[model samples]
Target: MLDACYDTSVVQSAVDLANTLKPVRGEDFLESVGQLHDFLDDHPALGPVKPSEPAEQHAAGARWSLTEEDLAEVRSVRETVRAVLERASTDAAGAVALVNDGLRRSRATPVLRVGDGGWRTEVVSGTDRCSAHLAAAMFGALASVIATLGPNRLGACAGPNCRGTFVDLSRNGSKQYCTRACAHRVSVAAYRSRNNPG
Candidate 1:
């Protein structure tokens, strides 16, 4: 089990990485090395996060140097993370297996670090490969969510034509759509259908 106060930003980073390739739109935002760099820039939590107190840090992987190989490997990790999000609600056991296998391949190790603020746990890879670091951070975050909350908290959006993945961190855990816009769009469409039944 991971820390009870797992970093939600890391969990969101996993979802953001998985959502970079939109299945319903058939659009891939992470197709190039530059895009991969952009992703790293946007989600710094996916990279080697520097602990506030380095002496207490157990492990922090190497800095990312993006490449074609790195892009390919990160995309592969994305597939596994996406699969977990899409399947966890229905097949919790299968999702657990996917996360476990990916974490094993990435050599993910969870470390408890004492920072200026307090103590927190982070997952890091043993190698310098950017993809492995990403896999460790993202897959480990998903695993933490499954262990903390139920596996059903991770899922795909219910909005029509949108396959966006998300972790339902809400207190009630009733999230069906990825965003407020998606939920409102769906609600309005249903209302229109009821009013203009023809």
Candidate 2:
């Protein structure tokens, strides 16, 4: 179980990672090593979670080297993460299997961290592999959401032209679209069709 106040950034990062490859729109935001670096920069929570870990202990401007291999591995992680998000609502057991397998493969372990902002639980991987660390954060966050808010909270956008994924952290858990823009687009389209009758 995760702290109720656990940072939502990790959860959002999982969704962002999955949405990087928009299947319906045929747009992939994470294609090159540079793009992966951008993704990592955007989501700092995906960094080394354990403060006492060697990775952090040696943090004298040390950063993981991004390579094609890392990109490939992360892409594979994305597939598993995306599948879990897409299936959690309908096939929770299947989704759980993916999450469990990912966590195991990533060697993820939950750790409690205390800071001025308060205490929170984070999942850190045993290895220094960027993909493994990312998988731990992504999979662990998804698992925490499912444990706390039920599997129905994970879903893909309702927009026909968009298969973007999202984690509903709203109080009502009524999210259907990946973004407000997508939801508005869908609503407007529905209205136009109803009025024109064509």
Candidate 3:
């Protein structure tokens, strides 16, 4: 479980979860979460979540279990999120559509919760609260990333072989690679190109 706040790891986890749905990789939910944590740690935002009025707790109830079928549906929604994020023109309308598409795919119902002295925006489903929690966590994480990295900075990796995206917080805005390895690869390629001149 993750706090519905601007925790970098949580956002990364949400993004990873979104990526897990791709056919290229096997379904590994826990692995996705772990990868997300690593990514968030690597890309630190200079800001933190501001404290707000305490959110009201919902009625205590039995925890929801995510069945395999439910997990599959969640994965599908994640794919939609990934598509929206990867697309070149992802506007507010696209974001909302992606979120709603996830809800529709999962058959999740919308519920209001009091958080940070205000209503938390989330979609819920009976007997599947975990899915709702995951969705909410993702929503919070995405919001944090957007606030921290403006649109221009949230870019896909420039590496030709990599499909990963990153929120570039670099001071000089010179972030062309997602990781040091990618940078090294690109640099070596450039050096070879210059030497070969072919």
Candidate 4:
């Protein structure tokens, strides 16, 4: 599981970006490239900040500056990531294979740094576009999540009207809904049905 805070680096930014692009607020808010661009601009963490050679100051990563091509690629990446998450939710091995293949395609490599705090692992990407970076980050974060929390921790929303997905980082791993609002919507609907019974 990713640390509650990125005291280390912006490793979870990809995960944050992925979660945000998903039909914000249970609505299809990210269907078009303009919306995706708006999203990147709306959220600071969603974009990667180009750092020095030693990989320093990653908090304010470089602006994505998405082009027409990048947007198209991002659409594809998002679809593939959603599939990977869904598959991993039910099948761990399959998910691993998918992530490995994606890493290969994105040319992402795992780097080990030996510091005073001991050795640690981080994903390094050579890609320049925002979409490619996010794809790599999505795979890396998902891989880390599977290693720590298990496959079932990631999945799509349970709400009938919502097409969003999420990673359940709750305590008991009993997170049945994507958000509390979705859960409440479902609960209120159930209560109303029970009371009316029409």
In terms of lDDT, model 2 sits at: 0.85
Q: By lDDT, highest first, what's the ranking?
A: 2, 1, 4, 3
* Residue-level lDDT for 138 in candidate 2: 88
Between prediction 1 and prediction 4, which has the larger lDDT?
Answer: 1
Shift of residue 70 alpha carbon in model 2, Å: 0.4
Worst 10 residues of 4 by lDDT: 4-13
Error of 4 at 104 (Å): 1.1
Per-model TM values vs. the true structure: 0.90, 0.92, 0.56, 0.74
Q: For candidate 3, list the clashing residue pairs, or say none.
A: none
Q: Could you give me the TM-score of model 3 versus the true structure? A: 0.56
Which digits, one per residue and each the tens of the lDDT, describe model 3 over residues 19-90?
A: 444333344443443343343333333111112313323221222233555455455556655664565234
Off by over 4 Å in 4: 1-34, 42-65, 112-120
Q: Report, for every candidate in turn, its global Cα lDDT versus the true structure.
A: 0.83, 0.85, 0.49, 0.63
Q: Write the per-residue lDDT of candidate 1 for residues 160-180, one digit (tens) a residue.
A: 999999999988899999889
**Candidate 2: pairs in clash:** none
- Candidate 4, residues 136-179, lDDT tens digits: the string is 65677677777777888877778877756677666778776778
Each candidate: RMSD: 3.6, 2.7, 8.2, 4.3
lDDT by residue (tens digit), candidate 2, 51-71 = 475334333113677799999
Worst 10 residues of 2 by lDDT: 53-62
